[model samples]
Target: MEQLLLNVVTLVTFDGAVNWTVGFLTTVAIFAILALALNIQWSVGILNFGVAAFFMVGAYVSAVLTLPAPEGLESYVAGWGLPIPVGWLFAMVAGAVLAILLGIPTLRLRDDFLAIATIGVAAILRSIANSVEGLVNRSRGLNGVDGFLEDQVQGGDYRWVELAIALVVLLAVYWLVSRATASPWGRTLRAIRDNEDTAKASGKNTVKFRMGAFMLGAMLMGLAGAIYAHRSGTISPLTFSDLLGTFFVWTMLIVGGSGNHRGALLGAVVVGFFWFGTPLIQESLPDWLGSRVFQVRQLLIGLLIVVFLLWRPQGLLAERDRVSRFVTRGPDDRTRGGDQGSVWERLRSAVSR
Candidate 1:
């Protein structure tokens, strides 16, 4: 056992392996941001879906705005000519704006209906990205965008710099999310998640709160998109496909503990390792099993999700407290006098009666 552990550690420490490790860490940091965004919606606002649309919008907007002018288009949509940081800001703002537009129509719907609506929105966005030639280059994707590390460093060693920057961004986001989840605004979001009507009765403006959470979550997703675009040094519409990207983010959030930011981050790191690392190991296996193991890895992931739902739906770092206070009473228990009162008023009267 000791020798096996030593071999694993040695492999991780090797110079050739460092780049892959850094790439994995970068993926974890990016998805950690995405998980946190979904947590704001699903865990804090009780909105289960729509993260995919926000994520796609962020990626597309950032890629388009920052992409260098194509050969003939210099006269038309000449690139914004802004620095990468400015481009990132634009990406985040665009995401927030789109979120408001998307949220207004669907926020009033119940859980499953909202999910379906949001999924439709994501599909529509992808289709538009694929079809809009002038805008996104029609599935060819946006290329030649200024990379975060472009022209700034030599080969081989530059990944370290990228890794360092990613770490800084991750830490900054971690601090911001930690503070936000403890703020009054965050508490209101949690209240809405637990029971929207109850939150409104307590004088919280539910619509306003929901919009705020949606926008904030969208902004974080946009930041993640910006990092992703720059990290790859290229952006493609296909990168935002609804399957693995969206499901992986959801899986990370679920595995980490939905309402907890720390859990979200940890879940991203844990799942990301398995998501990418297993394939590397499979590549080295004997010929008989190595070829088919990639398929098996995906099957294992699906099975894991099913098992988790069955045994620990709350997830690894489940929220310690029940944050919602809405009560459901049967018709037999609803007295005529209580029917005349608002939800809050009825609760008060029930206590006093």
Candidate 2:
């Protein structure tokens, strides 16, 4: 027993454990941002399938904007070597612009049709990135992309610094998203999502509201991509695969529960565990099983999705009930368990008015 304990302690150094943890949390932060962005789109009832494409655009745009000038034999264009924040800002702009261009033509289509169009868009983007040798460095991808504050931080400590920065970005995005979603504009969006006909009858322009939501969601997705690129320090067409970029994110949202921002964050952390955990335990399994561990991990994820959909479709966290902000509270409101009756009465009274 003493020998086994000593061996385990020697194998798992404190620094190694901390670095691994930081890397894992950073990935979760990225996923949380993506999930939140997707939640916005889902709230507006848009079935966007081109999320990977938007992510690729943001990565490449940020890479190009911030990269140093290419040397001999480098085929990619535009390495302006700008600051990282500039890259992040323009990545968002590119995403929103792409959304507008795509949304304008296809937003009016039915959900299924829109989904197909978006899939095609992702494929087209992938093909362009692959074939355009003069731009984005073709399949070779852009390398040596700058890290956030790399100049200021060095050595093993940089991982912790980057993780902190990633968390800060995640929190900022969460704050902005949560604030936006709780406002009247957000309520209108939810109203449109839940019942478009009723929202239309209420004199809301459903199409415009949907377009706005889509743009906002895409912008956040772009920001996520930028953060990912800077963190990883390299990117390629392969990095933006539909499976990794699209499917996994959708799974996170579905599992966490759609329409709830907190659910989105929870789902990201949960999915990130399985997605990143498989490799760690692979060595402990039989050789054949270890070799196919990724397949097993994917199968497990599929099973989880099926289970959640059939039994708990609302997800681990269901969307919260929305109450009117104008509802007044009694003096004992803080002590009350929850004034369900009065809350409903206020809602009814407000609706009647």
Candidate 2 backbone overlaps, count: 0
Q: Positional deviation of 11 in candidate 1, in angstroms?
A: 7.1
Flag clash pairs in model 2: none
Predicted structure 1: clash tally = 0
Q: Which residue runs of candidate 1 sit more than 4 Å off their true CA positions?
A: 1-13, 72-78, 284-289, 322-353
Q: Please give, for residues 23-49, the per-residue lDDT of candidate 1 as tens digits.
A: 667677777888887887775554545
* Number of the top lDDT candidate: 2
lDDT of 2 at 180: 91
Residues 1-353, model 2: lDDT tens digits: 00101122223788656666777888889889989999999998999877898887888899899999988777788899999999999999999998998898888878777788778888998889889878888888888998989888876577777788889999999999999998888999999988999999999988899999999999999999999899888788888888778878888998887888987898898898878866776668899999998798878888878877887676666564655656566445644322435434533432353
For each candidate in turn, give its C-alpha RMSD to the true structure in angstroms. 10.4, 7.5
Per-model TM-score on C-alpha atoms: 0.82, 0.88
Task: Report lDDT per candidate.
Answer: 0.70, 0.82
**CA displacement after TM-score superposition, residue 168 of candidate 2 (Å):** 0.8
